[model samples]
Target: MRILLALLYVSLVGAPGGSSLPANDSFRNTIQSILNIGQITLFHIKKLRTKLPAAPQMEFSTPSIDGLTSISRDLQILDNELQNPVTDLLSQIQADVSSMEGRVRLFALTMGCPVQARPRGHPWASLFPDSHFYLILEKVQRYLDTIFLNKDKLKVC
Candidate 1:
């Protein structure tokens, strides 16, 4: 009886069949890739901007226009890569992230917490208290914000 109970306990706790561990890892990897792409984009943008001659109108010169077009193409590729639903892990992560965001928002509203507090140490933050999910979402958001704020920095490389 004791051995049977122990075997059952071990099976329940150690099995991966019911776990989202793989999905979590995939999400983390995706977020890291996004951040790396953002860094590369920023670098390209800065290089192009620095190479430009100093003139208000010259900012939109031929070279700059060409660089911008290249940058745009790179961005499109990145967007397509992100949008591809090739892996079940990514799809699950995306769905979970969206659902978690919704739940966080709802919880915050119910608890009277500010929107900014939804990501971190807020009363309602515990709604999606899973560390892996939170970390992936936070990284994704950070990368997205960096891309948005440095939009002009994305130059053709």
Candidate 2:
């Protein structure tokens, strides 16, 4: 599962060594791919909730998944046109998403959380990539934030 996710990320985000962006699906498919990965990650996390240890809730508050619903509804309600400010904000948010995901990757390695494959026809991928990609990516960011903030929740014993 990790390998699958990695391949998808590399395909979409491209290699760090590249001198320029790979020019691969920079607009449409790139957004869709991110959405697909985000949806897949959420589905996997839901399944792993049982397999993984409980996260810390004493000092840090885990982000609520409910946020995604409103974000999604907002996206659906949006007209075909997107505002310049909104697009700019999404780009910045994507950068934060990337950073958060990076931190979570290390914690994921240490936790050794195993991912069960998403069931077939499970709507594991997002539909119609748009600004909603940011919404989905925001969801992924929240999951990563939860994992990174509770990095010590896993025990060796």
Candidate 3:
């Protein structure tokens, strides 16, 4: 939860105007929620790996990790530049995150890791499950679409 809180703080601090625009505030809230969901997904992945008897020798591609890192950096850049946000930028970033999540899901599948549904809890707490990485990814993507990428009308950050 500390990681989630730290991420939320960083995102809010980086966003432009500090809650002047309702849309921007909504975007910040959505992004924070996305990060928290991601943390839960990552936590489960780590827990599963540690639960293995002997680390279940598996070869994950380095490119996948590198790609994720690149996406994360770009997301940070976009978050920082939210003062003049670009719709396509967020769309592409959302797509990239989804792709990375897919890679993680495939990697887990190859290693025989199970993906489970979210457990019952507080609404926010129940957004993502330990094994529901793709679900978390989808939720983030959809939130970005609804809050930042509305095709019906453009949002000028």
Candidate 4:
């Protein structure tokens, strides 16, 4: 399950589109991709929840699952908002992203996984072909951090 989620994170947010669109257009496109990836992550998290046994090892089973479900529902609302083109939604979208980041981090800590905290404000131009990849890259890094930190914890569970 960790491998699957990692692969999904990499594929969904790994590559940045290098189109020569205007700055405004590129920002919008990147935001759209971020939103789409957010939805995908929520769905996969749901699937992961289903696979967890009714009786679990970890102490965080109830609250963690509840939090994930709540986030999934919130993402659905954000999805509806995304259908209409608007920059005003960016703040809300970013807030949702932040919430997911914290939840994922807590999930990792609960699972006892080691998280890889990437240095903040790293240059995307070196890792990605496009500079506009920051949003998704940040998401990917956060997810990766959670996974890297908690793999051992998962084994114990």
Best candidate (score: lDDT): 4
Total backbone collisions, model 1:
1
When sorted by TM-score, best at the front, the candidate numbers are 1, 3, 4, 2
lDDT of 2: 0.39
Off by over 4 Å in 4: 1-89, 122-157
lDDT of 3 at 56: 24
Judging by TM-score, tell me the better candidate of 1 and 2: 1
Comparing 3 and 4 on lDDT, the stronger one: 4
Per-residue CA lDDT of model 2 for 1-157, tens digit only, reads: 9999999999777655562455333423433443454455555545544554554332323343232232222222221112223334334333434433333333334335432221223132335444344444444446544533443332210
* C-alpha lDDT (0 to 100) for residue 11 of candidate 2: 78
lDDT of 4 by residue, 47-93 (tens): 54465434222221111222333333333332333232323323444
Stretches > 4 Å off in candidate 2: 1-117, 121-128
lDDT of 1: 0.39
For model 3, residues 1-157, the per-residue Cα lDDT tens digits are 9999999999988776655597556645644554544555444444544543433233322211222233333333322322112223233333444443444343334334543332223222333233233333333434334423332111111
Query: CA shift at 88, candidate 4, in angstroms?
Result: 5.6
What lDDT score goes with residue 77 in model 4? 33
Clashes of 4: 7
- After aligning candidate 2 to the native by TM-score, how far in Å is the CA of 16 from where it should be? 41
Taking all chains together, the TM-score of candidate 1 against the true structure is 0.30
Checking candidate 1 for backbone clashes, the offending pairs are 45-153
TM-score of each: 0.30, 0.25, 0.28, 0.26
Q: What is the C-alpha lDDT of each candidate?
A: 0.39, 0.39, 0.38, 0.40
